[model samples]
Target: MDIISIIAPMILVFFGYTIGSTRIITGGNEALVERLGKYNRKLEPGLNFIVPLVEKIAIEKTTREQILDIAPQPAITKDNISVEVDAVIYWRVFDWVKAYYEVEDVEDAIGNLVITTLRSAIGRQELDETYSSRSEINKTLLEELDKATDDWGVKVLRVEVQEIKLPDSIMESLEKERAAESEKQAAIFKAEGEKQASISRAEGTVQAIEMIAQALKGQSNSKEVLKYLVAQRFVDANQKLGESNNTKIIFMNPKDVSEGVGELLEEDTHISDERIGNGSN
Candidate 1:
């Protein structure tokens, strides 16, 4: 080779070594260094250096929180109903060394583990419990995942169920049940209202009758007052019967009621005249 060609290769090698040896890790990130295919050291955020050919960056990833969405998967409940459940998991890497070395594709491993645990948890509960115990399910999932993924050097912050889908038949049955319950409640309320109203009317009628009896007993004959009230009630019954569609024609003697009331008035008038005569005497 010529002198110029030799000089060019040396300059390129020198620049390549300088560039490869220097490493820059930004905020919210971590790096792993491996020397000769073995674990060497970890690189933190900001400036870092590695021995060009002897050491290399094995894994570089963000240490901040990450979200993993588990797609809808079939899980059978205790009652044997199939459900489609989808969830989101919040996770963060605490120890980057074990995170990179312990598991291949740590996120995937964690996801699969979570799905397995989710299925187990759902299998233990009935379908009704699944709907009402969502918080409990999340707590169980977080606890299980945090324990299981400890070797993976990650902490599970939270697991939330995003969607839970029931079968069409189940939904229809629930709708019918709700509708029936509503109708039953309406019927009960109507019966209670009618009962209360009947009681109020009866109480009012009794009070009015008692007051009228008292007033008549103080001023005139109580028996005549009772007879008049009975006759008036009878006439009112006939009037209401005539207004009804059940057309039963009835004949009543108005003179009979008038004659009875007229006798009572004459007696009271005679008594008042006798008192006046006695007072004069």
Candidate 2:
């Protein structure tokens, strides 16, 4: 080994070591360096330097928004309905050192935590609430997840429920219940309409009688005219009874009603002559 040969080999080694120690971290990314198998420092976006063998980039992660798709989980509601629920989580690694050191598998730990939390939340709510209160559920999940993931150096941006599936039989039963409820409401509305109409008809009948009495206010044949109006109303009432869907025993005979009205008018005997005179006119 002469001086030139030794110097040439040392120069090559230095160049190789310098090139190997340089690390380039790109946009929206970070790296965790571990010195001798212990946490040393975090590397931010852009060029970074480290000893080639003594310091290693333990983990590299994107600081930008990330998505984690949760597998479908089985849960039972308070109503005892079995359902499969799946969701997507928006999250990002805020601390690369904690994310790398604190958990064995960050993604797996988050997924399991979400699944367990969901099961617990769903178990407290009824099936109807689970379907109707999707926004509330998502809000609640986001809050819980954020709190739980704080120590893991993860920030949960949002939680979105992707799907909720129930058995076909349960769906059919819910449909039938909805239809039955609609029919019940319709029937109630119909009955109310009929009741209002009947009340209006009764009020009209009273108003008609009052108008007739007023028109014959001082007429000589007023008594006879009133008797005729009463007799007509009796016949109308009987006709409605016959038209009704209900089977009814009508107690008042139409002829008897007419006779009673006629006899009552006979008390105003002088009106009989007046009625005859008006008829002739």
| Strongest candidate by TM-score | 2
Q: Compute each candidate's TM-score over C-alphas.
A: 0.67, 0.69
lDDT of 2: 0.84
| RMSD (CA, angstroms), candidate 1 | 6.8
Write candidate 2's Cα lDDT for 1-281 as tens digits. Answer: 59999999899999999889999998899998999998889898898899989999987889888899998899999989999999999999898777878999888999999999888888888988998998999999999999999999999999998888897898899899999999999989977886787688779977876677667656778767776787788788667757757336366765676566456545545576689799999
C-alpha root-mean-square deviation, candidate 2: 6.0
Residues 1-281 of candidate 1: C-alpha lDDT, one tens digit per residue: 69999999999998998888989998899999999999999899988889988999998999999999999989999999988998999999999899888888898898899889989989999998999999999999899999999988999999998878887898899899999999999989976876686578658756765566555644556656666775675577568657756346576774575456546656765787889899999
How many angstroms is residue 135 displaced in model 2 relative to the true structure, after the best TM-score fit? 6.2
Instruction: Give each model's whole-structure lDDT.
Output: 0.84, 0.84
Give the lowest summed-lDDT range of ten residues in model 2. Answer: 261-270
